[model samples]
Target: TFLDAVSRARPEIGDYPFTTIHPNVGVVQTKDGRSFILADLPGLIEGASTGKGLGHQFLKHIERCRVILHVIDMGSSEGRDPLEDYEIINNELKDYQMRLLERPQIVVANKMDLDNAKENLERFKKKYPDVEVFETTTIIHEGLDPVLRKAADLLATTPTFPIMDDEGTESSVLYTFEEKRPEIEVTQVEDHVWQVTGTKIERVFNINKLNTEEDFYLFADRMRYMGIDAALREAGCMDGDTVQLCGFEFEFIEN
Candidate 1:
C-alpha cells in the first residue's frame, strides 16, 4: 500500500515515473503540517542475505531508513500463508543484516477487506504480540491516515545510524597491509610472445599515461619491482621477446 499512500498524498504521482522494480520515493504532508519522505522498496524474498534474488539490493536501501514499514498481505490471496510470509521476510532481513532488526518497524497488515484477512491478522498478532500493526486495504484507501501519522510520530523519535564504523581510533595510526599478490600473469602464448593479464596491472597501465621514454622506463621499473620481469624470465621469456601487457606490447630486454 506504499504506492497507494503515495498516490493519495500526491495526486500528480500518475504523471511521475514510478516503478516497483526500483525504489520509489515520495513526500507526504500530513494535516498537521508535518512532512515525511516515504520510500517503497522492492519486495524481498527468502535467501536474500547470501545474494539470493536481488535481496542484497533491497536490503541495502533499508540500511539508511530510520523506520521500516513491513507491509504484509493479510489475505492469503496469492496462496501464501500470511504468518509464514511474515516469518520468511523477517528472517531474510535479520539474516542479511542483524542491525536491520534493531530499527523500529511498523507492521502494515494490508488487504483487510478480504474475507480471511481479519482472522489472519489476529493470528499474526498472537504470534508477534509486541509488534505494532496497522490495518489497511489499499484498493479503497482505508485506514492509511493512522498508519502515516504513526510513522511520522515514530520518525520523530528515531535516530539515524551509520552504515559502517571507522576502524582506527582517534590517536592510533592504523596501517593496513594487503597481501602482495601477482598483479601480472606471464604466459607464453607463442615461442617468443608472452601475454600478461591481471586486474591490477591493467588498472596501472590505464591510469598512468606513459607518454615519454622516461615514463615508459619508470613503468617498466615498477613492473620489475613487482617481480613481473623475474616472472617472465622464469616462464622462459627471452631477450627481444614480445611481452604483451594489456593492449601494449614491448620487447623484453634482460637486465
Candidate 2:
C-alpha cells in the first residue's frame, strides 16, 4: 500500500503474510521532478539469508538498491516485537554474503494508526538513536512523501558499490590496449581448476537464475558463442578439467 501511494505499482496487499510471491519494480517520482526505481520485493522471513523461506529470492532483489526503506509494523499486528524485528532483519543482512547492511537505510514506522504503535515507535527511536525513522500509516498514505523525498536525496549522493568476487575478479580485467576489452575472462584458480569470471558473467548469473538442465544448456551455449570454451583451452584446460563459473563447478569437454 505504501508503494501504491508513491507509485502505481499496486502489488498484492493483504493481511496475511507473504502476499508478494515475486518482485514488483516501479518508478517513483518525487514532487521536485526527481525520480527513482523502487522494487517491492517479497517479504523476508526468518533465515532468509540462509536460503530458507523466500530467503535468497527476496535478498537478491535488493542488490542494486541504493537505499533500503525498511518498514516495520509498529503495531506488532502479527504479534511480533517491532524492535526485535529490526534486529532480526539486520542480522540476516549481515549474515548474507553481499554485505546488505552496508547500504543506506531509512526506517519506516508503519501502522502508526494502530494502538501501541506510538509506544513501539518511541522504543525504536531510543534503541536506534542514529537511525532516521519516519512515522507512517501506509494504509491511508500518511507520511509516505517524506520517504520518497529522502530516498531521492540519498540516491543523488551515493555512489555505486564496486562489483567483485573472490574468484578472479582481478584477472577479469586484462588491461588491454584495445578500446573494447573482453566482457569476460578465464582464470586458473588452481591445478586443473579454471574459473570463468567477469563483471558481465556475474551480472548474467544474478539475472538469469538458472535452475534446470535446459537453463544450464542455454548458459553453456552462450559461453560457447562468447568463446569462453576456447579461452579455457588457450589457458591450458583439458578434457575432464574442473571449470568453475560463479561458484558452480563443471568438467571441461573437448569435442
Candidate 3:
C-alpha cells in the first residue's frame, strides 16, 4: 500500500519502483504540509537472523528508522494466522537484534474490507493488548489518514537513530574484548599436501581474486601477517609442499 499512498500524494507519479536490490524512497507529505522521507524497505521473513530472506540487509535498514510502521495482513488471505504472522515477524526482528524491539512501533492492521478481518483483528487485540493498531483497508484508503497523522506525530517526537556501525557515536566505544578464537585451520591432506580452511582466509582468498602474480604475493604477505605461514610450519608442512586454500593450490616456499 506504500505505492497507493505515493500515488495519492503525488498524482503525477505513475508507478512505484519495485525491487529487492534497493529501498524505494519517497517524500510523504502529511495533511499539515510537513513532509517525511518514507522508505519502502524489503519485506522481512522468519529466520532473518541467520541470513534468511534478505536477512541482515533488511534489518539493518530498520535500525535507522525511529518509528516502525508494522503493516499486518489482518485478513490472513494467504491462510496464515495473522497473530502468528505478527509474532513471527516480531520474533525475527528481536532475534536479529534486541535493540530493534525498542523502536516505537505502530501496527497497521490492514485488509479490514476482507471477510473475517474484523474477527482476526479482535483476536490480535486480545493477544497484544498494549500495542497501538490502526485499522486500514488500502483498497478504499479508509483509516489511512489517522495512521499517517499518528506516524507523523510520533516522528515529530522521535529522534533519528544511528545506523548499526556509526563509529562517531560514543556508544560504539563501549565494547568488551574477549579472548580471540582460532580463525584459521591447517590440516595435512597428504605427506606433502596441506589444506587450509577458515571463514577469514576463504573470504580474503575470494575477495582478492588472486589472478596475477602480484596479487598472489600480496595474498601471501597477508597470510604471513596473519601467521598462517607459521601455522603451516607448526602443522608439519615442509618447503615445496602443495597447500590448498579456498580451492587454490600453490607450492609453499619457506623463507
TM agreement with the true structure for every prediction: 0.59, 0.61, 0.59
lDDT of each: 0.71, 0.72, 0.70
lDDT, model 1, position 156: 98
Lowest lDDT block of 10, candidate 2: 13-22
Which tens-of-lDDT digit does each residue in 1-255 have in candidate 2? 567778887554322110122466789998889999988665565576876523676677677777888889999875669998799888888887675777899899999999999999888888889988999988888898898899999999987754433644354555647465356888897677677767676567567645444555666676677777888889899876766665344567766
Where does model 2 exceed 4 Å of error? 12-21, 167-255
Best by TM-score: 2
Residue pairs in candidate 1 whose N, alpha carbon or C atoms collide under 3 angstroms: none
State which candidate has the highest lDDT. 2
Kindly list the per-residue Cα lDDT of model 3 for residues 1-255, writing each as its tens digit: 554564343212111110011345567777777777776665555566665423665677788788888888899765558898789888988887737888788899989999999999999889789988999988887888787788889899987665664444474454768565447989897677677777677667556643344555576678888888899889998876766664334567765
Error of 2 at 129 (Å): 1.6
- What order do candidates take by lDDT, descending? 2, 1, 3
Alpha-carbon runs more than 4 Å astray in model 1: 7-20, 165-255
RMSD of each: 17.6, 15.0, 15.3
